[model samples]
Target: MSVTGPAKPNFAASGRRVFDIEIEALRAVVARIDGDFSRACTLLLATRGRVVCVGMGKSGHVARKIAATFASTGTPAFFVHPGEAAHGDLGMITDADTVLALSNSGETDELLMLLPVLARQGNVLVAMTGRPDSTLAREAAVHLDVSVPAEACPLDLAPTSSTTAALAMGDALAVALLEARGFTAEDFARSHPAGSLGRRLLLHIRDVMHGGDSVPTVPADATLGEALVEMSRKRLGMTAVVDGERHLLGLFTDGDLRRTLDDDGIDVRATPIATLMTKTPRTISEDALAIEAAQLMEAHKINALVVVDGKRRVVGALNIHDLLRARVV
Candidate 1:
């Protein structure tokens, strides 16, 4: 007799069960944070050099993310592969640096082989592992136990829950260090000079605003035709109306041109710009952040803003297109 045997387990149901198990494991790891966690933070903070994080396999990926988080949040850190370390990369670890090692079983052969050399070099070792009693944890100055009761894999062989626990522990350590150091968003931006937050915080109006000859401007008494020509020439779609001292009086935009055109019997060349310009147009200081300028443009529902000096004199001009090119939009 041919028998199909037991039906296959529901894959979706199994996935949900695994997720729930990992969640519970993470909660348990979080609950276990106490004096040891504090001690690890203190040790890392006291170090003068970078925090060198090392791991193998899946733990290596988590270590890299942890290093990035620490680096961005005021702590200097980088990842070094354990396998590479044993093969002449060990020179990267200086006596001044602190080493954060990860191994799910707390007994990775590659990592274990380097412990004595690292210890001999007088480097502070902080081990993150599932077994507190393992060789790596016992040899370290501070041990963070990230044990998980079970793996998310149905066969219990994959590094799922254990890896999650390690990642969460790494984040907890980074955040604790961040708070202890009083790191700010501006500090984060300084570390990530290529990111959007960096652009928002570091880019000032002077850096992106069109200035001097590129700025579209016309004297307050100029005819509407002159202002329209200036706007068209500069391609900013707006022109600043300024006095002899360059102090802004009003602004004439395409919107104003449209309104003027709609008015009965209007002559573009004969009309003065001041009579059709929008008085008290939205303006920003030249030293203000680009993000702030973007916010002003967004709130006012306008595409451009006049950059002015402390005396309300127009010095520069900016539009949404400038912001977009600068990645501040």
Candidate 2:
């Protein structure tokens, strides 16, 4: 008798099938948007207090993420677990707040338990669910139909397609409110002070560059040896060549020195920096963003930059390391 191995599972096909189901579910729900969506946006836009999101199980996870997105995008919001709300966490909700509830079946006991209290308090109740006729949906002031044709799971038992629709709908609400409130990138950065966008917009060259007495600068008539001393003392890997009135004349970097040495060029003690410096070196204003400085360095294929003032006077100097430390790199 010949032994045969069990047939292999088609993992890729399984994934493709799941994707197809979710895509179809999304398409079906896209056609369900009606006046309810507009009503939800109006309630969110008119909310003077924070948005209170509550749900149970997987819907609670989605609700938490939605709350975070709303908070970061200029709307004040927080998540409250419906199970905990049956205890003391319900104190977190008030009539001044708007309640956003999520439930795939629209009959999650823990979530529905709060409907009566919310109704009595006269708080706006917004529900995202698959069953429009369910208790939670019927009690909602604004019901968003996040119903899907079928769950991505073969058994139709998972929250896959339904959760995706809820997440997307939450994003739609956040963005609509964001645009209506005229939220700008700068304002967005304020909420994300520790993130890359915050660093890019809030940090100026002056904040990162070496300024005042620490600036690496050598007079145009200074010998190469003197420029080397300044570069070493300041440790910026380069020195600015400036004129008598403090105007930037040129810049000399380690790269320039190495190239000159490769060519068997001038004596370090005898040659004036004016003869060896790169005239009209790339410069940035102290007021310019550190991100802009990084862009300039990357575009020119150079590492260091001289920070200048209104009249092209050397105000400071910085290199790639400075940007790295500032997290602008």
Candidate 3:
């Protein structure tokens, strides 16, 4: 007798099948979008208070993510568990709030139970459900149809397709409201002050550059030796060659020093810095973002930049290390 074992399951094919089902479900939901989406966005945008998103189980998870997206994108919103809302959590909601409820079956008992109270309180109820004729949909102020042809689950019983549709619909609403409100990246940076994008957008060159006397600079008539002394004293890897009026005349960097050293005809102690300094060196405004400075450095394949004003006067200096220290790189 030959020993036999169960065959290996085709996991990749099964996963692909699930993706196909959910993708088709999204397509169906997209086709169903009409004025109701606009209505939902209007209602959300006009809401005087926060958006209170409520659901149960997997729908609740999606609702929480939706709430976070809304809050981060400029809309005031939060998630409230329907079961908890029936308890003292209902106190969190007020008449000014807009209630967004999610239920795949449109018959979640916990969600339905809160409708009467929300209705009595005169709250605007937006229902996202698969069943259009369900009680929740019938009672809502606006109905968002998220019905799918079938669930990705083999038994067609799981919330896979329905939850995906609900999540996408929630994202659609949040983004629409964000655009209508003209939310800007700076505003987003405020909400994410600790994020990389916040550092990139909120941090200006003035904040990180060595300004005033800390900037390494040598008068245009100074010798290469004088510029080298300034570069060493400031430890900025470069020195700005400026005129008597403090106007930037040129720049002498470590690279320039190396090239000068290679030419035996030039002497650091005797050569005028202006003769070897790079005229029209790349410069940046103090108001530019630190990320812009990083980009400027990367684009030019240079390590340091001299900050200058409209008159081409050097105001500050910064190197890649400064950007690295500020976490702006």
Candidate 4:
């Protein structure tokens, strides 16, 4: 005999129904955000140590993500599984830490088992539970009601809407704390050093620019023909027009060559680069951020820039390719 279920359900309809239920569940959690939410923020802000997140089962998974978000957004935090806490991970929790516990029913056995220990350690326990009157809620220093109207699951047993509510509430807390602490993009980049955002925010123009002898430069009085040779040798497709002391005067590029070719009586070999180059060319400081260099390229509708020093002297040169190679683009 084979196990047969109800008529093949329409996945689309089922999914839509689930979305609708979860939306209402999310809406319900908003009204529950009262003075208790404010108190939880206060406790987290005042913590001398990390924010320790604890939960079991599905809530544990949510707890892990919450901890990660908090840590990355300027709040030092980590997750400790409730079951693991019973087996000695409880030592990780300190009296200076603030504990954020999650339990949809407010009666998870593993979490309840750790209540006395949490109290003994003097950890500020902020409970995110669906049942406000449950044991965990009653024991918590601050209770965030995560109750929902109903589960999106047809059997009302799977942790769907409740998990969504808890996750949203966690996000609310992280964002609130982030704003309170004035966390910035640079601060986040420090925490995510290996990510693309870190590359954009931390890497400076000098780090990737072609400097020293690699920078192609021709004296302002040098002929276009001489500039072309410098451009070819450097392979940057452009050459800076500078004074005898390397002070930036203008820029001549491969495109400038083409435009010069169209004009009458213009000899690439004889015409001074100063006469053909784009005067007052766009330039950036070598200490400027690579992303700033990228923005300059986009804003000016150009591909190359002369990297200058405090004295506006040409110290290096870079093109959009350098920005791309550095992954700033």
Candidate 5:
């Protein structure tokens, strides 16, 4: 038997309809946020223990994401399935902990069953539900209304808009808490040490720049040919021209070499690098961020930079390729 679905639906139009419904739902939910939101934040902040998030089914998925957001944004939190909590996982909740429960209908049996236990244990309960009059909301120390205008699902039976509302509310709470705690980007990087953002913010020029004998250097008095040999030996596309004490006097690059070749009168073997090198080259401190080095290159339209200390002595060198290798570009 051939089963024919409804005449070919317009997929793009269907997607747009869903977006329209969800955006309206979010607006409705946003208008309802008032002092209750502030109260929820204050209660969570005052907790001496972790925030334990609990929910069932679709709400459970949202709860898990909410828990992750809270944990990553300076609040210690984790999700516990309401069903599993019945099988002894409830032990994870202590009197000092705050419980964040989610239920679209506020009548999920598993969550309702645990309310008595949570109450008797003296744990503060914060409930997120579509119905303010539901038992879960009634019993909660604070209730967050996440009701939506309707589901984005065509049948209006699936958990679409309601879940979106819950997730948005969860994000709002997490960010508000993040700001209240005075959390910094450095603190965020510490928690996300392996991510690209951490690499950009935590990595310094000294950590990525070529140092020691690997750096291409030539005395200011060295012949242009000698500087070219040093540039080739180090493969940095450029060489730092230094004085007797290794103080950076100038820089000579492939551009300078091309100009020297064009002049015909300048001899690579006879001309001192100091006369042909750039007298005022851009330099950066080794203590600067690798990202800052990238910006400096982009701003000045240069390829390489000499790393110097407070005394302007050459310590290291790095170029755009080095930033790319360090994944800072």
Candidate 6:
């Protein structure tokens, strides 16, 4: 006779248990932040050179992210694999730099082996570990205890909650330093020039607006048929109705054309474009940011806008498609 096997445990329930435990562990870690945390921040802030973050195993992943966070938030920092450092990657560190080393056990052999040389190089060493009294912590100038009650892993051997706590601490450090240095969103955007926020902040309307030959325009006295031809030829779905001096008088769009067609009393071919055009149409300045242009389009429920100069004369035109192509939408 075959024996019955034990029932399989609920995998979802196990996952929830792990998540709950890690959440509590993170809360405890945050509550433990005190004067040492402040001192650690002060040490990093006082340093003149880049922050060299080092770690091994899973902690290494957290170290790399932390270094990136610090770098993007106005702190000069980069990650150095401790194992690689022993074989000459240590050359990246300088006498003016500060080293942040991560080791859950606080006695990582590779990290401890390099502490002396790093210290001799005059680099300030900050150790983050679970054991405050470990040799690595004792050798460093500052010791940040990232000790957790226990690992979230049922086996209690994997680095789970501990790594999460370390990551959170690193984020806190970067944000605090960011605020301390008064690093604004513009500064952050400069570091990430290829990202959406960079485009939004750095790109001006004039940079993307259609000017000169591309701007669909017609004189105020132009007939509606002339305006429609200009709009269709330019393909911007709109035309600027300007005065003799090129000052903006109004705007004519496909929407207005549709409304005029619906009104049987109006004749698109005979009526003057200015009579049917929208007066006081939403507009933006050439100096405005592309993000502002996007906002204006969104607020007015229109797809296109006329761009004017400081003197309120039409200089350019743009549509929602322009913002999308420029990655500013």
Q: Per-residue lDDT of 42-161 in model 6, one digit per residue for the tens?
A: 999999999999999998999999999999999999999998999989999999899999999988988988988987899898888988999988988888888888899989988999
Model 6 misplaced regions, further than 4 Å: none
Least well predicted 10-residue stretch by lDDT in candidate 2: 259-268
Question: For residues 95-148, could you state the per-residue lDDT of candidate 2 as single tens digits?
Answer: 899999999999999988888888888899999998999999899888999998
Alpha-carbon lDDT of model 1: 0.93
Error of 5 at 220 (Å): 1.9
Q: Write model 4 residue lDDT over 8-46, tens digit each, in one string.
A: 869899999999999999999998788989999989999
Which prediction has more favorable TM-score, 2 or 4? 4
lDDT of 1 at 157: 88
**How many clashes does each candidate structure show, in the order listed?**
0, 0, 0, 0, 0, 0
Estimated TM-score for each candidate: 0.95, 0.93, 0.93, 0.94, 0.93, 0.95
lDDT of each: 0.93, 0.92, 0.94, 0.92, 0.94, 0.92
All models, RMSD in angstroms = 1.7, 1.9, 1.8, 2.8, 2.7, 1.6
TM for candidate 3 is: 0.93
Q: Give candidate 4 misplaced runs (Cα > 4 Å).
A: 1-8
* Residue 275 error, candidate 3, Å: 2.1
Off by over 4 Å in 5: 1-6
Model 5 CA lDDT for position 100: 97
Residues 51-157 of candidate 1 have per-residue lDDT tens digits of 99999999999999999989888889999998999999999989999999999888899999998899899999999999999999999999999998888887888
TM-score of 2: 0.93
